[model samples]
Target: MGGHFQGARERPNGPRQRDGECSRGAGRNRQIHRGLCSPSQFSTPRVECTPTRETPIARRCPDAPMRVAGQPQARSTVKSTVFVVVLVFSLIATGADAQRGPDTLGKIKAAKSINVAFSGDSLPFSYVGEGNKPAGYSIDLCQRVIAGIGQAVGEANLKVNWIVGTAAERVQMVATGKADMECANTTMTQTRLKDVDFSNLIFVDGGGFLVTVDAPINRFTDLNGKKIAVIKGTTTEVRLNAAMKARLVNAQVTTINDGSEGIALLTTGAVDAFAGDKIKLIGLAAQAKDPNKFAMLMEDLSYEPYAFALPRGDAAMRLEVNRALTKVYVSGDIEGIFAQWLGKLGRPSGLLAAMYLLNAIPE
Candidate 1:
């Protein structure tokens, strides 16, 4: 063994050559051999091949990272690669499952009756008409929409299911699908869109102040410290507070049930002014025993765009309703519906006509 190592050391670049054939003075490169045998090894030193043991040297290519033979990292890399492949396939399968089928449209088609939520007190838009049934301009517009749906579904005469609700109540009814669409005086505000979608603009109104003709108030500021009546759960209640704070009109607010209640409060001197939509203020005032006894403030507080509210994410139903409304706007039927319900308030303004024209969807 000693002699063999001595010969190997003489040719340190490689194992010793055959007898008398010395690697020394030979201008040839040498190759690394893992077959070198040894009972024990030395760093960067040659070892003799022997029958007792074998020596395996872990080698790395020049400029390449060092790796050990029989190491566990290779097995780990294979496992990780397989895991990534499986995960990609699983994600694609889940995505395929997510393609939804029919929803609200199918339910409505199966029921064969379009459920409608109308307001009991929002006159001219939707209100309790003859025999306490739902009727108004908005209701008539919704009827036209239902007629279209009836034609599409081949029902020809689809039945109507009325669900009378207030402003806040109607919003919940539509969002939960308890009502197909709310044909009420619901304003199309950004905040409301979180829960439901609105059709084209139906009625454009703004906050107006109502006061008895004999009241000391002549302007908004005159109502300071005066009791103001507003309908509870309506946009007017919120707008009334906001307007009072912004203008420094420190008036006391009283929330009532409906316009009729506000009118009653005005007659009893319980409320100094009734604040609500201009159209509604006039509607309430026109119903008084003497129409000349009350007056409405000329200035508007905020622009309120009323539209029909429907269930959120029901694109099919919303599209059908919009198509029906657009057809009405293009035809001459809208004018008659407005005259029948809102003629007492006078003709539609130019801005109102523009609403119909702009929202009249083509095709």
Candidate 2:
């Protein structure tokens, strides 16, 4: 029949006929006289309609839609999967960019100069010397690091701008990018590492009390009910307070601005004792009006490990700084540098010598 039928098949060649043209007959006698007939319309069919490679589904059934229906959920799922993949890649790229951070070496190369923050009062480590220029043990080490930086950037001579400030101020300068490096008697501590990085250990010292010769204090226990002065915002100050509290010493603690001020306070009898790094106190005592009148207690309250402070998270700049420091330690040039500024101290102690030996990294 020419009319549509469900699950129907068509003949290969059939006589043309009008719609619904079929000969009526009894039981098995009915037949299509002159038109296409569906195999499903008869008990014994002549042909079947199965799609194959030679005949696609659309070709076999011309009324079928190109795309199958009722799959909107699947389409949405594919889009969501694609979006997640793209987002993951984007986050990875952002994290990589964040970790690469600022280029400190490139900035130094472009400026052809480096700003070094130093202490103008911490004698022997960093301080104002003859002609009002920065000079000391830490300054000598920083010069070598600067030279190494110059070679790394292909500059023969890089101008160094020495900025004078206190120890705490120097650390802030390096952290804020106002200074390239901080050359001072800055101690490397767990607290300071959060804001700034440090070079390899350059010097080691201990906190002690520097008092007038006539003072009644002979040991930490004698400092009860006495006044003591210490440089403000220094590791020595923090350690001094801790030590006093631990020892139950009821001494009055005062804060001074620098080593010079601490010395003045001790000399003027404003404080019974002055607490500072042992080596620094020696330097201050040696420069006092009456050197013979001052005596440093033969006791160390806290350990101090000194290093040069650099900007935090700058691995390349730190590598160069350490490389230069390692070279100085390896070549035996550190001896001369030490004697130039601290020769009056006799010789480097066993502890200090061990520090130099341990930090001498190989090329």
Candidate 3:
């Protein structure tokens, strides 16, 4: 009972109890005085003083007497003073508990695990590397994030659970409590906000097409009545449909589970075009059998702002993620990450660079 709250009868206007140990009574009193006082009321005072004269305590037992030293000073007043002191202590204790941060970090520390989700196929963002382990820009960034989380939570050796899945499943995993973080290339969109929360925009990308360099498809309008390969549950899927419809192109969409599948279909002439974010197309092109065979369509159909997704209710996790992103953005580390994974194309324009600098959180 070291961390226990005060008893019921000791709480102001709480229900009368035989021994005043009702926690429900304290809860009711707390609800009533939710904004009535501050959290410091129960703290031990720095100064101490003795009463010069004892007065009769109000609303107390008549038999009780107040004594300052060996001599009796006042009788009834002592009981009232004791009740007031107990009430003040209870209020302060309750407020302190209410202000305490959530134990998410503590839970991770105790369990020695940090679960995360990564897109299994989004190259340069998140994908399998050597030994089939997770790698890519987001994967690297998340490794640093996990390190920061471990340091902050005092779990330096925490085990990591790297869940690999499609982009669609990545968001659902984190949103449904199956994973703590989705270090995938999840775009920050209004629709995703319904079930998931996003950290600040970590990377920016645009929906573009990757077609054979000699193919007839030069822009969005050139793919009329063409077979377009796209990954399901991505902004590129939507953009493909929208652009096709707007340009009066009769496009047949083939939704693949991974980038390699899409590229394979395209290479075999099964699909007339492959649609994805420009950054992803670049990464995929680098891995293709013939890197020089394909080219990204200059016309971007849509913009996708990439971010890390966390569970909706975990505000502390969200804050830490934002802190990490803001740190990299301000420190100009993103340029290095971009260069490492995306080469020169990943560099943002002057406007976006200024935005990142402006929104960076100060330590």
Candidate 4:
């Protein structure tokens, strides 16, 4: 009588009741009262109902749906979903950061060593020297770079592990993490920059033809219908093929493994002439059995700007390499290195001297 059914009364004939009417009885009457109160009709009752401890009543209408314990409500479910999404994204970001790994200097400090890839057969630039160790003009420049790296990492006695490979293989080693950097007569081209970074210009050379002194070849036009030998996977090879195509020369190109091989092919008459960097060809011919027997053409086929190759996107390593190069250039040490490995060939040309002067960056 004191609850939401204060204005209702029991029907004398049947248990059915109209709106705002409820039966006030026990047992069967209470069941009929519960069935008659629809949730929508009693969702917002004007009269308040206070149930005592002896007669506990549900806060909602009798016909309202019941909630099982521990089930989440609609709003709570939305919040939980948002939280899960945020956590997943956080984990993904963490994984991406982990994959970035460490920088070049950190790796060097941890390993206490640096790996350098070089060409074991390319003379003057890089080659297997006395005692089967790596030596040459490029190797000397690389040693200065290594010394700078040692200073950066605070390791006065950093070990140098020289890995010998061809030009293509040396680039691959630097790109794939097998070596930290590659020191060779590697030319810096727009195409090679896609996979690796390069230091300042180290040397300047041009692609040219090397032929027997008595051979009939004198210029680019003389290469027509002749078999030319070049080292496989070199810029000279690509430039030679392009020059032949541009000149409309029908020449057969034979690829060899290294400078020595090209020299062998040309010496044996397997090819009419060998194509390579003019400076390297001169060094190779000088090492031949009869240096005077070979003649290098005066024609320049391609301009080659040499540099050291490092891992792509590694600005720190590149800076150190260039710093070392600048130091050598500015301190007059490069002249000594050039004279030691290439003095016999003659002094650095005017173009090469200008290259050194231009790349000597200030501290």
Best by TM-score: 2
RMSD of 1: 11.7
lDDT of 2 by residue, 1-363 (tens): 244223323333334322332333333323433233345544464423222212123222233333322344456656766877787799889999888756788999999999999989777889899999998999999899999999998886999999999888989999999999999899999999998999999999999999988888889989999999998889988988898899999999999898888888888999999998988899888888889999989988899999999989889999999999999999999999999988888899999999999998887
Flag clash pairs in model 1. none
- Residue 186 C-alpha lDDT in model 1: 86
lDDT of 1: 0.77
What is the lDDT for 142 in model 4? 90
Task: Name the candidate, 1 or 3, with the larger TM-score value.
Answer: 1
Q: Report the lDDT tens digits of candidate 1 across residue range 1-363.
A: 122111111113344444333223453324233333222444555544333333233432234443333434656666666877787799878776554422656677788888888888777777898997888788899889889888777777778899987788889898888988888788888878998888878778888899999988888888998999988888888888898899999989998878889999998899999998888788778768988999887777788898999877666777888889889988878989999988877888887888878887777
* Cα lDDT of model 4 by residue, 1-363, tens digit: 132212232224445333333344433222223433344576644333223221224544565564322334544656666877787799889988766543787789899999999988778899999999998999988989899999998997889899999889989998899999999899999989988888999999999999999999999999899999988889999999999999999999999898898999899899999999998899899899999999999999999999999888777778888888999999999989998988987888999999999988888
Q: Model 3: residues >4 Å from true position, as ranges?
A: 1-106
Tens-place lDDT per residue, model 3, 100-124, is 6344565677778988999877888
Better of 1 and 3 by lDDT: 1
User: How far out, in Å, is residue 183 in model 2?
Assistant: 0.7
User: After superposing candidate 1, which stretches have Cα over 4 Å from the reference?
Assistant: 1-57, 60-102
> TM-score for each prediction?
0.77, 0.80, 0.70, 0.76
Give the local distance difference test score of model 2.
Answer: 0.83
Give me the displacement of residue 245 in model 2, in angstroms: 1.1
Clashes of each: 0, 0, 5, 0
Question: How displaced is residue 135 in candidate 4, in Å?
Answer: 1.0
